[model samples]
Each structure stands twice: as C-alpha cells, then as structure tokens.
Target: MSVVKPLPNYLVQRYRGWKATTYDNNKAWYRHLSNEGQHPRAMIISCCDSRVHVTAIFGADSGEFFIHRNIANLVPPYEPDGGRHGTSAAVEYAVTALKVAHIVVVGHSSCGGVKGCHDMCSGHAPALEEPTSFVGRWMDVLRPGYERVKDIEDEAERVRALEYEAVKTSIDNLMTFPFVKESVESDLLTLHGLWNNIAEGALEQLDPKTGSFVPV
Candidate 1:
C-alpha cells in the first residue's frame, strides 16, 4: 500500500485575505480563463531559482507569458541538427504556438550557476565524478560567460560581467532558431535582457549600446 502525503491547501488557505480572497476578487476573469486556453504575448527565459520566480516578479496571470527555466538560464550554442533541443523546442513552441512577440532572458546575481562559472574561472571547482555532474555540465555551459568576463580585474566586476554575458548569450542562442530569426528579421519579434540582484533588490537592464546591465 502506498502512503498518502499531505498536500498544500493553498487553494482554500487564507492569509491576510490573500489566497481565497484573491480568487474571489478575480472570479469573473478566472472563470473566463477556465473556459479558454492560454494566449501569452511574451516568452521569458529565467533562472531556475525559486526566489526569482518569473510570474510573481512580473505579476503575470497564468497565460500572460511563456516561461522557460534553466540553470544560469544558459542557452546552448545553436546546433543545426535534427537532434532534440529542449530550449530550442520551447522557443519554437512559444513563437509558433503561443505567438509571443517578445522574448526576454532574465538573469540574477548570487546565482549558483554563475557561482559555478566563477569557481571554474577561478580554478576552484569542488570535487566532481567527472563523467556527469550537473554542476560540472552547467559550468561548462558558462564558458562564454567566463570568456567575456575573465579579463576583468575586480572579483565583483567579474561576477557582474558573467551575469550580463550569460543573458546576452541566451539571447544569442534564441536567434539561432529559424522561426525566431525570421520573426526578428520581419520586425515581428523583439528581444530583451534583464538582470536582477537578489541582495539589493535591484534590477538592471542590458544597455544594448555597451552590453552592460544598468539600473532600470
């Protein structure tokens, strides 16, 4: 016999009139949403950090954006292959199925993935089993970040550079998709890069001119 685990009662739980009360407040639109499928206008690639939830940060409804999460928000360098590309697949579906017009890559500071890249760049990785440790693989994916930031002198500056480069690299990878590239060429889709700092609660956007993330 399988033991049943207790489930969260978020559906009914109330805290300062936040939960069920919220549902009650949005009942009319929620009811309509239940009857129809999602139609999001933007696609966001966010880090897999729980504290950096995309929808919550943006106050988005269930169907407002197509979101994909990954370590460091890394988008693998494009491979022109018939092989399955998980990130590519999501991008294709977002632009094709959801008809999203904007794609955003969101990065954050104090990132474990960015930390991994920092450790690797500083020659300080912890012991790993070689053939396959997720951290090792993720660090490998962040080589481009290191390449962009390694020459910097200050430690803090290096981390900041990695944070921004990682976001740009993901955007670059998004352009690899034929659909994304074509849409961009046709001026039907736009790309954006965003950075969030957890400690300071600061948000910085990539300055397309200098490729650095600046406040607001």
Candidate 2:
C-alpha cells in the first residue's frame, strides 16, 4: 500500500486550491524578497511536528521568522560535528549574519519525541543502538531534566515539569554560543521560552516573575 502510487484526495484538493492563489497573491512579497535578502525579525527553534506550525502560531508571513525545526525541539550542546550544526548554524546566522533580535524555543505537549525521552527516565530504554535507533542516544540529552523533576507530586505535574524542563534546557543550550551569550547580557538579543498547548487553545510563557508557566 504505497501512498505515493496514488495521491491522497484531500492533498490533491489542497494543492489545487493553494496553487491557484499562492502565485497570484504571494507574488509581490516573493518578488520583493528576491531583490532584497531575507531579513527575518525573529529566529524560531521549534519542533518538526506537523501540528506545531511556527508560522501559523505567530500569524507570520514570508521572511518574518528564520525557522528551524528539529525532533523534540531539542538543542544539543554546541559542538562541531565536522562541518555544521544545522540548528546551531541557523542560530549563528540569525544572530551574527541576519542580526535577528529575538530567538524563541517553542515546545509542545503530547510530543512523541518528548514522551520517548520521558520513557527513558522510567528505565525502559534499551542500551543498544541498533540501525535507526538513535532514541537511546538522543534521549540522553534530556536525562538531566528527568532527574530534576522526578519528585513532583502528581503524575500530570510530573509530565508538566518535564515539558517545562525541556524548554529551559534548550534555552541553556542556546547560551553556549558566545555571540548569543553576549547578546543576552547586553539586551541585544532576547530569548523566550514558550510551550504551545494546542488542545487547550492556550500558549504559555515562562514568567521569571512567578517562576512558572503563565498564559500569554
């Protein structure tokens, strides 16, 4: 059963509709941006989940945000991987090359990648790294977050804390870059921690004043 053999009906309909208006309506912005390089206002580090749409969440249009999506919205510690760190490269370009003022790390609830990492905390994750088995190694990045919140009173609270912990961890990881650190210190660049709760129709921002997530 190959989906590639026959295109899905809904996808074909969407493609037809979007293709009709996209060129006519979006041409002006595309033409303008072609002459002038992309000057996005913010750099968004977000999840690759289809539901976690960075542009739609902010109601952003073309070139508004330099977006980078990765599994679990995780930012591995800054290290050279022979050539480039894809997410880090975007952060470097957005900070140094593009000079974006804000960089936001967006996380979400019921994320499978996050859930997989959380399950590793329960000692269910295996030690072996078989073919296509990076979950063990990848979840290692979030082991400390589980250690930090293993004592929460409620099951729901425990998950909530893990989700929140993931956000802060990425923020901590973002600061590993000297340019980002200096910008944060000088107020040249601002970092934001956001958790998008699609089910609740709510967006939560980590408020330093209350030291908790509050509705934004």
| Top TM-score model | 2
In model 2, residue pairs whose N, Cα or C atoms come closer than 3 Å (at least 3 residues apart or on different chains), thus clashing, are none
Question: In model 1, where do residues sit more than 4 Å from their true spots?
Answer: 1-4, 8-19, 80-84, 126-129
lDDT by residue (tens digit), candidate 1, 1-216: 378855557643545366457767888887787788777889999899888977877889867888899888877876768877777788888988888889999999878888777877677875432547766765676787688778899988888788888898888877877888999999999999999888777788888898777898
Q: For all the candidates, what are their Cα RMSDs to the real structure? A: 2.8, 3.0
lDDT of 2 at 99: 91
- Candidate 1 lDDT score at position 33: 76
Clashes of each: 0, 0
Instruction: Give me the candidate number with maximum lDDT.
Output: 2
For residue 10, give model 2's deviation from the true position in Å. 5.2
Measured on C-alpha atoms, candidate 1 has an lDDT of: 0.81
Worst 10 residues of 1 by lDDT: 11-20
Please write out the lDDT profile of model 2 over residues 1-216, one tens digit for every residue.
554577789999998898689856888888999999999889898888889987887889888999898877877788866855677788888999999999898989887777777767776555423345776666566778888988887867777788888888888888888889999899999999999997876899988777678889
